[model samples]
Target: MKDWWIYKGDPAVPTDRRLARLAEHRPPWRVFEGKVDPDHKVPSLDDKQYAADRERGAGYLADDAEIDLVNTALLLRRPLLVTGVPGVGKSTLAYSIAEDLGLGPVLRWPITSRATLRDGLYRYDALRRLEDANLTRMQATSDEQLLDAPEAEEGDARPADAVTPPADGIGRYLRLGPLGTAFLPTDRPRVLLVDEIDKCDIDLPGDLLTVLDEGRFDIPELTRLADHRRTVTVGTEDPDVRARITAGRVQCRAFPVVVLTSNGEREFPPAFLRRCIRLTIERPGEDKLRRIIEQRIGAGAAAAAAAPDGLISRFLERRERGELGTDQLLNAVQLRLAGAWTAPDEIGQLAQATLQPLSGPDAT
Candidate 1:
């Protein structure tokens, strides 16, 4: 149906406003039913970074094809792989969808050269647990040491060190990461942004396949305790929030909206690529660049008119010679408006510094 469109690319829309299709629709491929921890709450949307990200995402000007791809990914329950140069708003798309759909906070997993799949799932501080156990053992005191043995005859009271409780239950040392948090079970899907995924190691992309397909993952640390400690409350990605894991497994009732961004630095495995819905963002044209400026700041602002006239034209002209990101344009505008230099030539030179090419021999 025409009304099936949830994200219409209109920045004016707010959250808590889902279309009938998204509200009633259920993924036919969904097989797991994760039980959410009633006390666990997602981070509040009032954070400063959250506000800035929401604004940037809402202002993103998505074309018709981009919009179609987003909706398609949502219906098919697949990850959206966005490839583009830096500053093209690939990562912001996830925040846009989250804000538009009333998803509380966008779960972000920033990739690095050393990043691994396990790093994004959860962390078990086994060493810290071991240290605490050692400290408890060393601090052992007897009743006679406390002078209680002389005052009152002890019948069954044992030393504090005699009964050490499984290092205070393994849950205290466990915490979920961004990827793990995003897969948490709930009626509505959470938006997950895997930023700069291409920066990860060669194996990371292929490593993500299992969870992407199953919408579930197992925590061996928690699984080991299942025999006795059935439900373990552990820390979540959200600060101060803890969740209960039943039988060491984390499943999802609704698959998260996973958006993986890439700089196209390297090629991905064909098998990994097959599972994702792909979208490519090209450099914004002069007109769209101006729109981005207006969207970020009002067109009437003095900063909008900071650069004399040919600044944008010059930017696009040099873009032909080397790769330049839109952020460089914004930076140049800010530099000009900052009153950093007075002489016209000096001002031009300073602005040029901000608009340097991101790639090519000129980059250095």
Candidate 2:
């Protein structure tokens, strides 16, 4: 069986105790009770698949400390803040855990400079709703024209202005964003990957502070309708999945495992940092890199690129000199094995293009 050390913290604490602690740390959000098709639950990897999952070269090998930090975060139900250089698998860690545990598909929010808290919470398609409403009105008019002449005569022709706009369900158009969906209540906790958070504006992290701490957010559009209706079924991140919100609020039953990844481009606020379990993903070593190569491509591919000559060794040397990201190694290997170039001189030129390091003031 694959040893998925989801939690490796505190040898002094009994394993049962750690499990119990994590179970107790449920989110403060409300439960999900709605009429809809059930969610899709992909089974966790079996022994063979698990082995394949681990051996795939792009996988991140967590050190004891990193494993401990992850376990600690799980126990405490805290958001994990992962910082690392590009291509170090900061975001992949989230998917790894989700796949290992069968936590369903991961909900990802890729952050950008213009991204904001509300952007991550929900999206209201007002324009689409309005257009749908107009279409419905036109269809109704067509149906009236097709009615028998006598029936049409019996019904007085009301002015077009008298036509009431169709109620295209507003909640139908409002879909939960990745962050909001993660806070949704469910039988099992979901995994949310917020990628490249450091690319967001300075206030983005601070804005998330409250939502993370509270584990909930409200949709005012739904809230307004809630005054008339007790429950509103709304769209979610999952396809064909709908959740019910009472009085326009969505809260979690268990806090979703939140993985916020950064590229070490910027520092976070103290308050924001305090609420998170921080992990710095160090660059993979030679053995890890070899494993990554084997995992990503195939063992045969790896052997083909690595046999006779020290391909992996040379790649590591370039990395040691801060020439390129670890992904470049994979690129180089793939090129070598594919017989892209047979001449040694041409291969070296290809390597130069593939492994060029960052230059200028930022180069280090």
Candidate 3:
């Protein structure tokens, strides 16, 4: 028996059989129904954005261990919990995975304190629907009054009939949020970035566990109308892209590549942690930072003269004192190499201001 990874994490690996391999590893307990319309369209990434997304790994290097963790998550069909300090490219990992495997545009659900599971799934605008209904009713009354008028001016032309849009089309009022759209039964898995999971309420992580484990969710509003309307097409987070929900259910053909990011602000419950494949991204070392700079700035400029080796040393020194994001070092290097501060006297002052620690003044 041969067991191979769905994503080998190599650029050279052909993705033609990726979907098949993903389906093969799915646990027997998991069920799948790929009833999605073959014609259904997801949003397309433009050339400029696509090119940028493909270069996500160039911004930060993901080591063999990180790559193995990602592959493990994919093979097991589990959500990846990525924890890191700010700017370690936890969020960027989602984009890299999506682009590397030709997964469609990432569906990002940014979490906040007020965010609930329902919020991530879909939003129903009941107030807007009610307002539209009232407006339509008034328009109809006005049209009726005009038609019922007995007298008309001799040379005046009759006004054109008013057309009222139906306010009860249910689907128009319902739009699937990022999470819901990810489970829309596309031929391939979607990449879902549940950005900043640590910021969510205490209950949210537990709430998410069910959906991630099952790979399906229901919309009650649509369910109520199921008898009359078996299928409803609704908007997704992607502009102009709508998914078809059959009998008010959204289920996955393949489990999505769900990357939930956290800044390691808080701990999650054991049960919530149990189902996820977790990866904690450590701060990049000095060697890694040099390579990242060489990749972003020209390799020639970063390695040769005027590249600011002093700035790199200053960045590492600050790391000993407090948390410092990699981008701060990149910025300072770019400034020095561009001749922003050619004078030697002001170098320390400028580097200090530019590479400020991420934590508060009280942290020390």
Deviation from native of the Cα of residue 26 in model 2, angstroms:
6.0
Which ranking of candidates, highest lDDT first?
3, 1, 2
- Candidate 3 backbone overlaps, count: 0
How high a TM-score does candidate 1 get?
Answer: 0.86
lDDT of 1 by residue, 282-328 (tens): 88887788877777655753244335544576677678777888777
Listed in order, each prediction's TM-score against the native is: 0.86, 0.78, 0.90
Model 1 residue 109 lDDT score: 96
User: Once model 3 is optimally superposed onto the true structure by TM-score, how far is the C-alpha of residue 322 displaced, in angstroms?
Assistant: 1.1
- Mind giving the per-residue lDDT tens digits that candidate 3 earns over 1-364? 1235455444455775666667676777766776768878866554465667667734556677788888889888888999999978898889878776778788889999999999989999999888888887887887667666787445544356554676438888999999998988877888999999999999999998878888899999999999999988888888887777889998888788999999988999999898989998989876777777887786764564234546667777778888888888788877877878758776677677788888865222
| Better by TM-score, candidate 2 or 1 | 1
Tell me which residue pairs clash in candidate 2: 29-251, 29-252, 56-295, 57-292, 57-295, 57-296
Candidate 1: worst-modelled 10 consecutive residues by lDDT:
301-310
TM-score of 3: 0.90
Per-residue lDDT of 207 in model 2: 96
Off by over 4 Å in 2: 1-21, 24-58, 134-168, 300-309, 321-323, 342-347, 358-364
